[model samples]
Target: MAENVVIEINNLAKYFPITSGLFFKKKVAEVKAVDGVSFAIHRGETLGLVGESGCGKTTVGKCVLQLYRATSGEVIFEGKNLCDLNENQLRPLRRKLQVVFQDPYDSLNPRFTAADIIGEPLQINSDIRGSDFDRRIAELLDIVGLAPYMADRYPHEFSGGQRQRLGVARALALQPEFIVCDEPLSALDVSIQAQIINLLDDLQDKFGIAYLFISHDLSVVRHMSDRVGVMYLGKMMELSERDEIYKSPLHPYTQALLSAVPIPDPAVEEKRKVIVLKGEVPSPINPPSGCVFHPRCPKAFDDCSKLIPQLKDAGSGHEVACLLYKTSWP
Candidate 1:
């Protein structure tokens, strides 16, 4: 791992066992949620993971945070392999590694006030209590652009955007070095989404926090990410710098995904080609043989159905897992 890299996930895989039968509970199949996914998040940099729903984007985040223990592979954070750590050992490290879930309304406790929600982490991790804790909670509320007086109100009282702000405040309560923002803006209105995005940007700049931003919104991902990774059927199809991936996507899946993003200019939009993929995504329980994307890939050949293309560099920090780019690989 490089000194600048905050987290390195190498061949990270999470599989859920699918069982059948009532008495015996026989293992019938396994859902390969995240399989052989590899990437690194640099210090203070945002790495966007974009894919269609059920592509295992959220599963990757959960695996990194150890919410779901990975079936295999390593999640190395700050020179330490998190997979080896027990729950007791991992608990201490949780403060430095936080997460902001997609649904703010569902994630936050309705029974607790804003102050209680934000202060709960502080209470668990540290000895700060009484007026000190109150002051800290107040400061956090202010930091997230909420009034300090709003601390007394419950999560139900706040609007969708405000609830998200509170969630960000709680994540920031521990001053984490890395945060997994799992589609944080997906639930909010279009206008409110921008505000939350800007808020996250500002917070990242101020705190120098690294983010593994997972989303299906290509436009939003392109806007916030320093680097982007494209996933399909539990495999990473492409990875590259923000501009490189958007400008020249190497993989067929990546190209198709980028093509779907609506252009701002009417004239350009009219002229641009849309690469619509055929058929629905295959079930992860029994993915396609060899290259999982071969079924729908427009450029796939006979080799694609026989061999799984390794993700190799196509120069200039761009990586793609496709036979088309194999000649470029060193």
Candidate 2:
């Protein structure tokens, strides 16, 4: 592990196997949801993951949280490989890693009151209980900008934004050092999204927690992340510093993705030429032979279909898995 690195992943891969015959199932084909995707989340820094739907961005977050076991490779957190740890070993470490899932309504338990939902983690993981737990729950609600009075309300009683605040409150209850904020803003109103974003920023500043913020919204990712990683069909197309990724995208897929986001200013938006790809994203079960984005790439050549491009340092820590950046294609 390097200095200030909270978590490091190397060639992480996850496959969901398809089966036939209900009684005696036989393996058919597997969905390569996440294949050879690697990146690091530093202490107190957010690493934004952006891609089209079914591009394995969410799977990456789940795998890091150990919600979904990786089929291969390593997930090193705080110098220990999480992939090697079994359920018993992972139970204790679970306190240090938490998740704020997409769809606040779907993630929360509708039957449980806000207090129950937030206090559940503490009851399971810590000794704080009764009045101490109550006090902690109140503090958590305050941390996420929720009133203590609202703790008695059910998930259905609160607004979408308030429910999301409840989810955040629960995640913070354990005081985890790292969080997997999976599309935390996608389900909320635009104005509400701003509130949640600011709350996350304030939480990070106060607690020095790292985040793996996953979403399809490029603008939100740009605002929250220190560095961004682009994935396409389970492969990381590009990874670079936030500003560099936006100003100068190296991968063709990355360029196309960024171009699609509308600029705020009409003058710039009118002048900008959006790079539209030709075909739909390929299925993960049967991906392309080589570069996953080759079928839709504007700059793809014959070699792109023949060789798998490894992510290499283009310059200034900008890693791109595009053959265009290589000297000699073999």
Candidate 3:
């Protein structure tokens, strides 16, 4: 991971309107997919975003890439605010920021050949043409450990892992400085997942690319990320260095989540007490007053239900949003 910052996301929020009626006219509520999330990714580093399903992990990635227009926030990439850029202004910057979606089967076009698929971005963003384009495509396939001959084949002819490799190849065509890996390994088999993860690490080392990796798997996040952020109900609950977050989790929610990860050693697993959460995640449409996790948090008290806990520094750059760590509550 490089020391220079590559992307900055500040107070980002994304909401989807829900309408239900005879005429489908009235806006009943808004799905608060992402709300007031802020983080920064440095060049050549991987920032893992982890949370349960529907916790807005993927939405943060899309909002950063400007794929989904944020309700409010600033996404500054390379010192420029991407939110203010129009379509034409964003076109050039698209090469700098790329995304790899989760579904290999759905993300790729069935009709397009692998060569065409990977070459599309290069063609749009760069002036490389004729033999140069063909050569570059071949090199990309080789870089991704795919045979150059496979380029002529369509997406359907490939297996799930192969299709994902193709997607990676496409994302790499631009030689992007940063990538939003939106659960890219979730669709692959366990064995294939290892291979893809190894490949991503190698590519990062070689190209010096930064990654905003979003996933629900804490173990995977631990392996790949330099820093990790835990989200719940569209709000960040914890943020810290990967090892610190795993080793000494300050928040009760963080401790509960880590306790659930199965230990390979039977003795350790038996000795551990899993802190099972008390309630289901609160609806983001109408989040609970005070801390959103108060309903599920074991350590929550009267003040937790009355005043929202601010994300404050616990120690060593670790931050947590919980009343237990606060001076008043403590």
Candidate 4:
């Protein structure tokens, strides 16, 4: 792991057991949600995770925050392995790691007032109460662009955007260093999504918060991420700097994904080739042999089906996993 790395995920793997049967006999079939993912998030950096649905993007984020217990590997945060930490040991570190879930409405408690919801974490972990808690809640609400008076309202009273703002406020209340933003804008209207993205950017600038922003929206990822990692079938197909990945994608999967992003200009849209991938993503329980992406990869050949490709730097900081860059040997 590199020095000054805020979060390091080494060979992280999270698998959900697929069980079938009635009462006594349950057979186990594993769903490899996140498999052997290794990456590090430097201090105060946003690493955008982009992929299609069920591509293990959310799983990776959840694992980083220790929400899902890793079957194997190390999640090192601030020089401590989160996987090894017991409940008591993880309690203190919880303040430094937080999450803004996908659905804001579902995430917030319907019964509790927004104030209580935001203050819940602080109350649970510390001796704060009464005036101090009230002040902190108010501050957090204001930070996320919510009015101080709106703290008394339930989640139902607020619009979708407002509910998301409350979620952001709750995440901020802990003054966390790293946050897993799991598709934070996916549920919002396009107009509101821009606002939330801007708010996140501003917050990062002001507080230097590191973010693991998981989303399927490539354009949004490009706007928000310093570097981006593309995942497919529980594996990383490509990882590179934001601009580099967008401008010159190396991997076939990455290229196809980028080509699908709608171009604003008519001329550019007309000129760009549409690289539609064939078939569907294979079941995680039974991924294809050699290269998992070979079935859908446009550039895939005989070698792709017989040999697994390693993620290697092609040029600059761009890393790709494909046989295109690999030399044929006798």
TM-score of each: 0.98, 0.98, 0.96, 0.96
Output the better candidate (3/4) by lDDT. 3
lDDT of 2 by residue, 132-156 (tens): 9999999999999988999899999
Candidate 4 per-residue lDDT over residues 221-287, each given as its tens digit: 9999999999999888888999888988888888999898889999999998889899999999998
Candidates sorted on lDDT, descending: 1, 2, 3, 4
Candidate 2 stretches with Cα past 4 Å from truth are: 327-330
Spell out the clash pairs found in candidate 1. none
TM-score of 2: 0.98
Residue 11 alpha-carbon offset, candidate 1, angstroms: 0.4
Global lDDT of each candidate:
0.93, 0.93, 0.89, 0.89
Instruction: Say what the RMSD of model 3 is.
Output: 2.0
**Which residues of candidate 4, in runs, are more than 4 Å off?**
327-330
lDDT of 3 by residue, 289-316 (tens): 8888888888888888788776768877
Model 3: lDDT of residue 94: 90
